[model samples]
Target: MELRQLQYFVKVAKKQHMTQAAEELRVAQSAVSRQIRHLEEELGVRLFVQKGRNLQLTPAGSLFLSRAEHILTDLERAVGEVREFLDPEAGEIRVGFPHSVSVSILPAFISCFKKEHPNVKFRLKQGTYTSLIRDVTEGEIDLAIISPCPETHELVKGEVMLTEELLAVLPPNHALAGCKSIRLEQLKEEPFVMFGEQYSLRPIVMNACLKAGFVPKIEFEGDETDTIRGLVAAGMGVSLLPELALRYSTHIEPCVVKVDPKVTRTVGIIRRRDEKLPPVTELFGRFLMEFQPSADPGRPMDRLDGA
Candidate 1:
């Protein structure tokens, strides 16, 4: 089948509405429908089945959709690489960052990179570590900044950008609030305010607690760090949070204590392992790893290691 047919099918599959897909593609609804039908005929399998007003992908359609999306993404990347090779400085890079990184180095990294490569445009996505890795694996984003580098497929490569200390957060009036440092086991009985299960921090904290010999009693689970910190400040629970999160907060009700064993989260850059990145993306990735935010020069920035 032609590339155009695959493109139309992917759009329709994503939107699940012929008219919506057509509008997104800037083509007529009839044309989209006809091309999708032709694609199905060419594949000798039904790709979509109508369910009320929405178009649903059949089992065969679901399988084909994944392949079609990968093909389209690869084609786009190939074209981008060629264009960027010719003009080196003029290409878009899709970069993803988890909430913690976004609050810390993201602003400085972007501002510094922009001053250096003014023509390079960035499309940024803020997501959880899990979502960032999924997007990178699916080719939806070129690179991501994530914490506690993940176990990835052979196709993914990563390098440590920096490591940040994970501190225990509690209400200012808590018994241990005045302490300079606390061990993981000491907070075993404390009710924890934690990010949702999808966040990479949750697993890190849980594993640390498990090693310390107790499962944490989670009193609240939320999506945002600031919200969770607020809960802690209100005495709802205690939490383990990255030190960078404190830098962005104006609220002073929560007291942060260094962990005795000094828990740390390693933040890193992840990209496709074997694929050559576009010029702008490659340059941006390097810039990010080397960027030392002057505001926190005391924190250690790690060197890049092969994924």
Candidate 2:
């Protein structure tokens, strides 16, 4: 019923322990218990039931917890917005991104943005493609750098910033490692190392292989770009990765070969379509639209010996 009561209830729901929740809230355990009791009486439903020493949310309790959390989050954002509006240049921006872009694209953009607006702060959250998009839609993050950006979504809007090629990465000593370009069909007999199903890249690579007339034999699955590259470098299996991911790092250098069919993914930023962004977030969004990565003549083919 009261803001403090909702806060106490949500914290208790999360911790599932009265003492621990009170400890976290820096309040007396009896005060927490009193607030929880008042909240349940106002709602006319038991929010939590005891199991052993821990508490479990009853059905109604679970529902109310969700609403309470949303309300608290909105209130917090409203307060932050008012503070940010007073001095947009010194505000904070929460941005989400996937690991694939973490190597170069994201750090570069942030570095450049900081040079001009050094007082502005950033809170970065790295997640899978799907999770990043979900965070933006749910208000957990203000903006996200997503790959193979969605064409349309009900809750979010995407803007394509750059389109980069996805190339085949082979072990340095593999038979095809020296080739200028390799066709997808040529790797049909070889085992592949690939990103897990959660990654957007997996489906893109799978469809590309499927179109080339074969289902790749996946030998290993990993979440990190560097891990996949290391697997390929050690002859665990070959993989297809974005060019930017391969270009910026020298660790466990694999033989980078161009995909003959030219697979590529669009890198873009997404934000909630319904919400008017905070002043700092809006400025960053505009910068993203106009920003471009500097050109490097270095191609995957250059990684091969005697090219």
Please provide TM-scores, in order, for all candidate models, with all chains considered together.
Answer: 0.84, 0.90
lDDT of 1 by residue, 1-307 (tens): 7999999999999999999999999999999989988988888999999999999999999999888888988888888899999998889989999887876678767776777789988899998877888888878899999887755567678898777788999898999999998888999989999999888899888988888889999989988878888899999999999887776655546998988777788888999788778888988888877754344444423223411
Residue 244 Cα positional deviation in candidate 2, in Å, after optimal superposition:
0.8
Instruction: Compute the lDDT of residue 159 as modeled in candidate 2.
Output: 95
What lDDT score is found at residue 156 in candidate 2?
A: 92
Misplaced by over 4 Å in model 2 are: 297-307
RMSD of each: 4.0, 4.8
Total residue pair clashes for candidate 2: 0
Global lDDT for candidate 2? 0.89
- Clash total of candidate 1: 0
**Top TM-score model:** 2
